[model samples]
Target: MPSLVTPVLPSGRLNASAQPALPIDGDLLLRPWLASDAAAVARVFEDPTIQHWHLRKADSEDEARAWIEQWRRGWESETACHWAVADVGDDRVLGRVSLQSIIMVGGQAEISYWTTPESRGKGVCSRAVARVARWALEEVGFHRLELGHSTANVASCRIAEKTGFALEGIRRRALLHTDGWHDMYLHARLHEV
Candidate 1:
């Protein structure tokens, strides 16, 4: 059996490099969320599609600031890593990509993402997910990465496949959204040994 290796930080959290900026396709960048991005974050969440799937609305800039802080805490605690997907020239927020439910000992984590209305259909989420997955597997030493989304979300399904995650299976009534229980399709990619 192959032995597992976990990255550990001095602070007792999983070692995620301090440099959070991940470049994608020259025009896009994925970096750690900042407090100043509260307004843009709130704007992205204002999309009805984002609100429906995420189940909570960040209707105000304050709420968005709190959301950013929560993810920042997640990093300190090593529970998650969230990044702002931004345009390189203007530094405008285009979306977000995250590695949530990180378990270093288990060599696993789950991926999630959302894009602003303007960014949809542009492959922003797909490229961001692919970059994050590579970083998680190569630099962070995670062996398996999982992504699950409502089966009704065809865009998310496409992003999963585009990023090299294979369809694993579906979990009936796996997630509860505002509308009702949603059947979720789970996808995954394993590190190449």
Candidate 2:
């Protein structure tokens, strides 16, 4: 197991007063979430599979707007490094990857990702996850990275495994999704190798 780390971060308790520019994919030219991104983000959430993975039921633009706002707040607060991933070639928004739970002092963070349902099983998420993981470990100076996914979401589990995250253990009844309280696999990656 990787050594534990601790970096102070926001409690994720408040909304940010403003927006902050975030890093885009190196190979892909992703843009940060803008006020205009509400529609797109809503569309992603409307995908049954995506909603199932995220455990957020589909709703109208009004509901999606609230959630997107929270995501935006996370970015502006520096509590989470969130990005809206895109394809460099065509500037298509593929999905999003977040380096949340950042512990700057300890060089550690946790990662999460979700891709457009149409883009599933194409290695899109895997490549993007790996890219952000590498950036966090090397460029961002993080020494450890962690990820988790619903136990039933084999694809996400596979993504974590493919990205070099070690299966730490199961968090019993951890996620209350459409399936109710479901087990979750917690994975971690560290610079120690």
Please list the Cα RMSD from the true structure of every candidate, rounded to 1 decimal place: 3.3, 5.4
Q: Cα RMSD (Å) between model 1 and the true structure?
A: 3.3
Q: Flag regions of model 2 displaced more than 4 Å.
A: 1-27
- Candidate 1 wrongly placed segments (more than 4 Å): 1-19
Global Cα lDDT for candidate 1: 0.88
Residues 16-62 of candidate 2 have per-residue lDDT tens digits of 33333334445564456655666778888878788777766547777
Kindly report which residue pairs in candidate 2 clash with one another: 7-103
Overall lDDT per candidate, in order of appearance: 0.88, 0.73
Clash counts for the predictions, in order: 0, 1
List model 1 lDDT by residue over 113-162, tens digit each. Answer: 99999999998889999999998888666789999999999989999999
